[model samples]
Target: MAKGQTIKVEIKRQATPDAPSYTEKFEMPYRPGLNITSVLVEIAANPVNTEGKETSAITYDSNCLEEICGSCAMLINGKARMACSALVDRLLDETKSDTITLAPLSKFPVVRDLAVDRSVLFENLKKVQAWVPIDGTYDLGPGPKQAPQIQEERYPLSNCISCTICMEVCPQFNTQTNFVGAATIAQAKLFNMDPSGSVLKEERLRALSGDGGIQECGFAQNCVQACPKQLPLTEAISDMGRDVFIQKVKDFVSR
Candidate 1:
């Protein structure tokens, strides 16, 4: 490999949800600090494969190019990661391969190419009621205050970008289990710890106790590892698990 050489990229392409998947190999001039999104942009400009055949532009989701939106997650050389932040130099240095591979995240059904329907994560959040409920839009003055200590503890959990990377990497998050994965569980714990949000605590716990609930998590610790936001996922999962268990016990005794 010489300076200013071209980097070969192999991108998986699919025209539609029902279309069969195909691969399109591209060769773009290598640039220092070039990220995956930039490479795709270059491909879009040329729209030619390594074999010099004309091809359709690659389709992928990207918003907030700074990695906050979490929309650019894809399989980069077999690793599930955000395309925006994955540096090409680092990738080349590590893999020692001039060719880069891009593919859609596999855990979810592809909508087109890199885009997949992630509404399941949102729906799961709804199932857990992952929010602080407020009644009467009329101005409620001076809500309960959270101690700094509590705020400090809850802040890390709030960092979840809803990327679904955690879910994608989790073995429990599959069609058979319908497990909600760590992000949703962390959100459950986030809202449950809020003084105002705790009003519906019992209901949230009950929701988690049902099928596709917290019990589904295998505690593989993959979520904690893959979370880009460095959220305290396992801690939240452990805390929520204990709380859900307690709620179940109380329900059993009262019944």
Candidate 2:
């Protein structure tokens, strides 16, 4: 690594959803500890391709420059990852290729360049009712106490940032299946475990039983591997599956 070395990036670009896609190469001055977001900012500043032709700035979603926002997820060197957390040095070291590649997440509909419409994840969340039901702002007394043991178990499931990396890597997540994927399942598990939130447990279980629910998961285990927050997705899926099964049995008996 020498001073004045340039970092090469190959970005897949599309003007609109129906437009033809193309790859444009960019060269930026190498800087220590630079992330992919910073590299895209450099491209935006110049808006010139490697061929030195004037081009439009790369369109991508980014905010909270930190990894907490989870809006900067993209394919970096053929992997679904958060651009804000992906370090250039580590990426270069792993691929051993001078050029870095950026592309939109494959499982989602591309809105522009690297920014794809991730609203599907939100729609799925709505289907599951993944929150505690509460009424007006009237003061409710102290809620039921949860044991420390329960809190410890539910803590890891709450770390999901909804980045959809799990959905991207999942084999079951596609147009044909409409599988909700692991994040929503993990979230359902989180709420179901809560003392106050579990009031809707039966409804949540029924939601997971219908089309595009937990049963659609193929258990390829890709979600667990792809999750940046390291959530216990497989375990949550297993637990939720069991709960859904029990609810089905109870409903059958009552009917």
Candidate 3:
């Protein structure tokens, strides 16, 4: 790679939800320390394809311009990753080619270009009641104290940014199955361990035990590998799976 060398990016573009998808190749002048998001910004500044044809700026979601936002997730070189964290040099080296392929997550419905509707993850999170319940916003001073061990156990699960990369890589998260995926399951575990949050543990467990819940997980563990935050997803899933199973037995006996 030489100074001012161009980076070739092939983007799969969709005009709208009902429109046909097509590929567009863009050549961006290389700059040191360029990330995928920066490349997209450059392309947006100069909306011209490789053929010198004027084109519209690419549409994609981005905020914070950091991995913390979890808004810039897309398929880069066929891998689900955050565009903000994906460096151009590293990607070029990894592919061993001049061209990098960019596309929307296949599991999600594309709104336009690389932007996809990721509301499903929020819906799934809601299903598991992945939050601590509070009666009122009014100063509930000095809440319950938790053991150090409990905090240590639940801390990693709390790092989830809701990027949905776990869902995107999940084998069961598809049109055919209503599988809630690993992120939501991990969130349930995180809250269930909370002192106040544990008040709703049975409710959370019951939610996971229902249709399109924890039982639907195929245990492929693709989610654990793909999560940028390196959340203890498999451990959470495993623990939640056991709890869900035990809950089912308890429910059966009570019946």
Candidate 4:
């Protein structure tokens, strides 16, 4: 991890969603305070491969490069993580290698090079009704008061940036099943905890009770470790799992 050394980078690329995929080699001068995004930006500005041949600019999604938007999520050295937070120096130290590897999430459909379709998460959240219900956009007076303790509990869940690293590392979130993954479940728990949002609690719980539901979770707990936000994902999943079970039992008994 010395300064001004050349860091070799390998990027997985695809011209289009249906196009054949390829890998490109790049060389970036190791610099102080260099992040993965910086490496990508440099390649984008230069668009030259290791062979000194001109190449297309790398395609990827990014916004609020501070890890808030979660758009810079990618497989760094074969691990799901945020590229914006992945510093080249620290990465080299962690891996004991001068070469860095970048690839799109394996489970997702690659839109281009490092970009993938993550709208599935939105659809999952939609199924769980992961938002507070409101009648109109009209001025709704100050809503229900939340205890400091409750607020504290909810804060961590609220920090989830939808990076999908949890899903990427999840075994259940594969082609074999339609498991909604940890982000969706955590959001369901977050909204269900809200005073106003609790109105749809029963519906939300029911949504997760059937196929591709909470029962599908393998409880590997990878979500807890991979989440960039460090969300209480395991706790949320556990609480929601209990609630979903009780909800299903209630539905059965009432029938």
Candidate 5:
């Protein structure tokens, strides 16, 4: 917390997906208002370990440094959070220690260092068809109007940056369970609420009725708490769960 003070960070590094992971210690001079991304940048520029050994630049992903890109999500102090907004000062204060631990999200395959393959979330979104169906071949006239209250509810759900923090925090999101986690479910809810998008409502509900679908959610509520955008994940999950159930009943009756 003073001039010349240094912060110790232990980073889990993997050169490739199949490579073994190991920890590298770094000591960076303390800088006020420094976030984890900035620290990584400094470390990259120096590429030196605590023992003064030359090392490769840390491999990671970052963009928009403002938490919008969601590419900076990683395990900081054993918690999934956006490194761009993970303030070093706050991390130190919380841990009450000089050393901070960094690792890739455990739920995904490690690409390298703090980077992991989050393509699973996107694939899940594809499964749910999380989008408004509009063929924009030509200018379609004005769309149906939505009430202000509807917008108010949908706005928060739409803020999902696809960081996969929800997936990372979810205990149900593991290799054994095909659970899609909270983000995809929230996006399904978001699109399903749109007046125009509601045309595909039944399809979306049916999509969520299958394997690795809404019913797979264990409701640990960790996704809601860990979402960087504070999306109404639990609410969306509950709504989608009910909808999925109703769809199943309707399907049974129709058959």
Candidate 6:
């Protein structure tokens, strides 16, 4: 890309959560290494539509230009992705079009233009008790050590930034089923495997046993594909599913 060349961007905007949505087009000078977030910055610098009409600066959420923050997740080119890492050149090359499309994640409630409510994922995490149960803040010296093999398995699961892309791409993640989605399942597996977090393993397994639980997964595997961190989502879900089944059996026998 060179100076004087420009990229056309189409953004889906809504003035408020209850307001109607409209599309706004803008042209920004093309620059090398420009990601979707950078394009938004340029638009903020000059909030003019394609018709040359002055407009409100595009409202979007972003922080940590790097992909680590996970707050910049949105639909880029009709797919769930992180705006901070969606490179303009690669996007244009992929579509072979001068124009790129941006929108809020489809499944989430629109908090504002390009920003959606992803609290559902956090709420799901709470449902599964996706955390190690620490009894006290008091310095209890030397916790039980984990084996190196266990550490290797837990590391990738810990990389989940709760971006909710996995949920966004899932077909089962809708109001009808109220499915907890794969992120919650993956996190359940993560904490359940922990040397200390395993204290809540039975509770986590029980939590996943009923409606909106692991059984809701269609196994489309979209979650694994859409995950920015390349987590073993399917593997975690499978393991959790097996564990949940075993937990049910154990409960039945104990009765």
lDDT of 3 by residue, 179-235 (tens): 999999999999999999999999999999888998898889899999999999999
Model 6 alpha-carbon drift over 4 Å, by segment = none
| lDDT for 144 (candidate 6) | 90
Question: Lowest summed lDDT over 10 consecutive residues: which window, candidate 4?
Answer: 1-10
Q: What is the C-alpha RMSD of each candidate to the true structure, in Å?
A: 1.3, 1.1, 0.9, 0.9, 1.0, 1.0
Residues 9-41 of candidate 2: C-alpha lDDT, one tens digit per residue: 999988898888889999988888989998999
Candidate 5 — which residues are off by over 4 angstroms?
none
Compared with the true structure, what per-residue lDDT tens digits does model 1 show for residues 175-222?
Answer: 799798899989989999899998889998998999998999899999
| C-alpha lDDT values of all predictions | 0.90, 0.92, 0.93, 0.92, 0.92, 0.92
RMSD in Å for model 3: 0.9
Question: Which pairs, if any, clash in model 2?
Answer: none
- Model 2: CA > 4 A from native: none
Model 2 C-alpha lDDT versus the unseen true structure: 0.92
How do the residues 1-255 of candidate 6 rate in per-residue lDDT, one tens digit apiece? 567888999999998899999999999888889999999999999999999999998888898888898899998999899999999999999998889999999888898899888888889999988887777899988989999999999999999988999998899998789899998998999999988889999999998998899989999999999999999999999999899999999999999
- lDDT per residue, candidate 5, 143-193, as tens digits? 889999999999999899999999999988898999888999999999999
Model with the higher TM-score, candidate 2 or 4:
4
Q: Model 6 clash pairs?
A: none
Q: Candidate 3: which pairs clash?
A: none
